[model samples]
Target: MQKNPGAKTIEGDLEEALFHAGAVPEQDRGCPKRFDWARSARTDKGVSAVGQVVSGRFYVDPPGLVQRLNSILPPQIRIFGYKRVTASFNAKKFCDRRRYVYLIPVFALDPSCHRDRESVLASLGSENELVKCLECSERGRKVEGIMGKRNFDSKIGLDVGKLESGISSNNQDAGTTEEKIKDFSLGANNGGFDIEKTEEDEVLVQDVNQEEVKAIKKSDFRYGEEERERFNRVLQYYQGTHNFHNFTTRTKAEDPAARRYIISFDAKTTVNVEGIEFVKCEVIGQSFMLHQIRKMIGLAVAIMRNIAPESLIETAFRQDVDINVPMAPEVGLYLDECFFSSYNQKWKDSHEELSMQTYAEEAEDFKMQYIYSHIASTEHKEGVVALWLHSLNYRNYPDLRFINNNVNNDVESLGIEAKDGEK
Candidate 1:
């Protein structure tokens, strides 16, 4: 789901690219449309997908096909491999699950002056130095508190009552499961995801709910082993169905549409060139609403920072509960994979179902070089996550307007487009 402001969708551009490149025939695609095209996910600006699948008729054979498509596509977008699927298959309908990986730099998690609070405070033992650190933290928390309630809907203006009413209802299953999710990590090596690692822990019982937790590893993180354990445990809270109204905009707390099922969430530590450990978090789920994943990570980070209570998660899931969820940067997020087992089972004998393995190895390498590097570079401008955490301890906005507030909460209706197509 690649996007460019003031430009057509990546899907539309791809069709044109393929047609002009001699894949979709000009005649077959008439006013009624010659070939069918469908995609599995939708992404907002600054988002990238490495294994997004789309179904359409192609004119070329399997050999040298990837090279041919890449020749016509832009440098930012690449054509991986293609697989022929059964006629009954629809890319959007047959898809079962979507997986995402959020990459974080270990150094970014550290406070501006030092790796952590104790380290920062210890280096500045004098009374004057202690006061300065507190002052900086106080200022940062002001922004973080504001960001917790900030969202596309609030910025655009939406009716708060209807939004909460819609999501808080019993219907929004988001299709997760009714089972409880558990945290079971073994050691600090796998991206700093150290757990009990006992044989009993390894023998995880497979229930309908456990089956959904797909991601079992993590990425680079800057926190210590203690923080890593807390981070992993916090992920389990998001495993089953929950009211995610606070995570997205323009949705009611009771809205059934607000419920989403998270199958798996895990983390590990990765060391950057400077030797700082960055904990990378991976979450796989049935699907997510707007800004849901980022908020989850943001809240998790705040908890690890000891700025917010883990009880906030429990409150967030309750009906009509208002919780501030600081949003994580989108730069580190990646659409790692999508599953279509429901349809794949029927067609596995024919091929490996629909996948992007053909160019996966190369495409991922290119993403790390071009995409991840740029995200890390731009991060220098402002440490969004750190600033947000600072706000957890303190926030002062006398005139701030939030939908969850009890009194004089104005409901303004405005036209906002919903991109339910991509994740």
Candidate 2:
């Protein structure tokens, strides 16, 4: 239901599709159509959900209703289970906490720093190198726009320079090859395009270029022990109450609503998918600000890669810093689970008990067929993350204020809260 578009042309997400499928004809259906349809979490576009809950009222609640709903809806959108809740239930407010898992390819963290790894690891955030990486990328993009993209190699104070000269030269950046074609993509390689001429390419990601392309492969993108330890420590900082005003846009730093409670955040090197390994990050919290999770991961990756200092994360939490945080690719993020502790406790005590549990086996099957398959294919073939990295440089990493690349902007004319509510 999360990644798949609904059947109706009006609204295309799971929630919208469910409402349509559950909806009965106005005249024949009881009650006032679908009343109080609420979702536990509003997953962003392209995000998959294993445990998502929704509650609403229909005129009739007959036996096999769940089956009927699935029969009517798309197979990609399945109802794992359903529960009856009290009249006081408010899916948005009453819920206690939400948990999410973001699975990024381990290669994204591949130190891009070759032999100088020792020095880079020693001083992860020594001199704000990440700013250099971002700013340099910004300069390249601006040059590409103003000047011909042919001369897009804008490399001043690029963090990749920190690498050993030998390793730096041998490791050509894949992005440079993308510049040749009008539509740039990492997956666009091996498509009968002659990249042999693009070999002398400079300005790899963060101004890194590998002379020996075969020396590094997608499998080569990985995190070392030192990078893993430091990333985990940085993740710990995400917990507890903090002002994430900079993580999102439009909200003022002084606004009390900007303060959010994070219970825990952790990450580890995992090779869950075939031929690819990535840091699997999970964060649990009462709620998150818009684009909060993506930005958090982006900053962490920058620090881990030794492109930026660890202090950037701290400054982001502070109200005084006017930092427009950069976001990692949204393709890697997923809404893993949502918890309703208080609601479940109350229901247990009362005469009625709500079945808020999920069917894990079935849920896993659905995700593999519909969700993970798309992510893997897109990552391997289409180069979603690569395109997103390029996008970070778009508009010079402008403020992440309500940009919905997933839903067609054309739908905005229809007006159904396009990309509204939840990060």
Candidate 3:
């Protein structure tokens, strides 16, 4: 249901099919409820969402549901949005996290059209060259600014020492209240004015004191240099909750700017099998501006690639940099997760359920594709092997099938029985 150019046509077809099947009630036959669905920014003609959420009541027979829907739905689209929700539950507000994955194959080619091997090699080299150039251009820039609990500009009015002092005072007040309650309870148990401490009570008191000491000791927290900087920047902006109207994009023409509090920001890196690496930048706030995540990612990518210096992030915050740098593509961005103080457990459970559902759906798709590939290979055995081997060595090595087959008997070594099941 998430936006497709052909959605209106599909909806009409579905309505007609349901009418023919007598699925709708007599009263509702003349008026089917319309639905409003959201589409991704990059959705295109042939592309489709694998896991889109939609909510609506439909009257249909269980036995004929698949048939009726399939008859109306296009081959590229399917009904993957059939979730039930509570009346009070809002999908956007209740969602704690939305994770998206962008997949980029190290090697790819058009399968339908055949090209000369020499041209294919030349194209691959050109792509590599372009990627290298981009990487080099990105690496030369620097970004500057303090992160957590640090002073950005003196004018911003940050007082870290005072904040820490307040936290310490609060801790002392809590401790004093706890001690007074314990003393009061002890006094009540004692007769009139006399106070007596049993050996068991003394031991219990000692254990409790030790535990409190351990807890206090464990509470001593510190941040790494980079982490401290990132945290300070977020806290500086997020501490006093405000409308981030200017920070984010508006969905509706009249919708108010989003109210947000910076929760946290963490940056890390990942290394792939081929020694290629990527920096993973994660920022969490109460709410985000439209495309904010992607923008942040773009900044980070710019910094890591050296296209912008570390100072550039702070400059952007100060509105000093050119705003023309469009946000990074959504494919490489993810909604990592969201945070909620109220109904945290429910939100967590829902996220887990959604994640598991996505995984299962993806697994099923993979399974079907695997089956299809095996079937196709069975019908074209020699061609499949040749294609597979060509893919394996296409990037870095030469095609040495003749050498391998003659010298090491790789065909037999691979457990492929020669014709008549003999090696």
Candidate 4:
């Protein structure tokens, strides 16, 4: 049986009802009751199920069993209803995909304090630290793991070229030109390259936004060149269908049971409305082993911290490799979403209706609490002003793109000059 953490209370209540109805024995009337012949699938605590299905044989009448179960279930964890499928139907085998959605607050600090004056001043100098700290927090780290696959050593860099290669290999001629066109469009919009043209009378040049250039320059937010290349190598090694046993944490005896699958991972950084920045990583896979995501996030964090050697990722990608690195924290992680080939229309419709109702109620309660908090804090205008000031500084800071570009150019040239000097 698969259990949902969020439904524990309701599950317990239902168990009691089942006991009363003689569906369960007196000794088996508790939350973690064990049935001698049944197998269990364990899931993390606090994880909720939306449309999970389970099957079993019972001596009691099916309709009566279901009705009794529903009667004791809490409104928060209601059973939407169920249907009988073919006798050969297997809930796990028939599942095409599983999706999870995680709601994350964009900015780390209190949203209201962002408008204060003192906050604005502090934000300008402390923005990077704040972002790093927030992301390093337990919840942030956990969410990062949920976003990707990684080696047991906890390395999480993605191989974009490898992903593209896999897709190409599968369909051969599929999406090649279309992918190039999309890439070109995105690159052009992001100012990835410059174009030169000459008119009949004179040469015209497109001007780059100095502020944008500065922002790009100031954003020292990615792996170093050598580190990035090593990461790419690791990704290339893992491309296509290959057993990921070595990349996962498991006992030697379990190696024979390990599986191979395809995975696509992407990472990018974006600035939010509040001027706070974040790194978002998305990973799609046929399936993943235990702790795969956590390990990957841990690797990424290590790379970001300049602690791990870049080649470590490549080594970890090898077959039967034993990567024993600490896994990253889980609080920052979220099972963002799942995908399936198709969904039941009626069930989907009902689920949407129920979700909307729940959200509406929650929204009303939140609004009331917010109003009360605002009124209670009215006298603390000084503190509020400080926070607002911090937010403003974040929004109005001068772009650092020019400085960054100059530094990068100088570094490159310095290397060239040094080589010549050595000669």
List candidate 4 stretches off by more than 4 Å: 1-42, 46-51, 56-71, 74-81, 99-240, 246-248, 267-282, 309-311, 332-423
TM-scores for every predicted model: 0.64, 0.64, 0.38, 0.39
Tell me how far the alpha carbon of residue 336 in candidate 3 is from the true structure, in angstroms, after superposition.
8.6
lDDT of 1 by residue, 1-423 (tens): 533455545555566666665666678652214465666776665555666666655665333444655566555555545555676566667778988777766544443422234434554755524212221233232111111123212112111111000000001111122112110000000001112323322211222233222211122334778767777898888888888987888887768999888898988656342222346678888888888988888777665654455655665665544555677777667667777877768767875545544445665565555455544433432344444444443242111112232222222211111223311
Per-residue lDDT tens digits for candidate 2, residues 1-423, read 222233221113333433454433444333322465555666555455666655555422334444554555445555555444577675666668887778876656654422122333454566722112221133222112111112334342212111000000011111111111110000000001112222233334433355333223223444678767877998998889999987887888789988999999998646455444556799999988778898888877666654555655664665654566768866666666667788778778652333323355665565555555555554653344543444443144433333333332343332222232211
Give the higher-TM-score candidate: 1 or 3.
1
Ten-residue region with minimum lDDT total, candidate 1: 162-171
Question: Where does model 3 exceed 4 Å of error?
Answer: 1-50, 64-76, 80-83, 87-90, 102-289, 318-322, 330-423
Model 2 misplacement above 4 A:
1-34, 59-61, 113-221, 351-357, 387-423
323: Cα error in model 2, Å: 0.6
Q: How well is each residue in 49-150 modelled by candidate 4, as lDDT tens digits? A: 233333222234433444454455333333333333333333344344433222112222223222333333355665432222111112111111211122
How much does candidate 1 score in TM-score?
A: 0.64
* lDDT agreement of model 4 with the native: 0.32
Give the least accurate 10-residue stretch of model 2, judged by summed lDDT.
Answer: 183-192
lDDT of 3 at 347: 52
The local distance difference test score of each candidate is 0.51, 0.51, 0.31, 0.32
Better of 2 and 3 by lDDT: 2
Clash count of each predicted structure: 39, 18, 30, 43
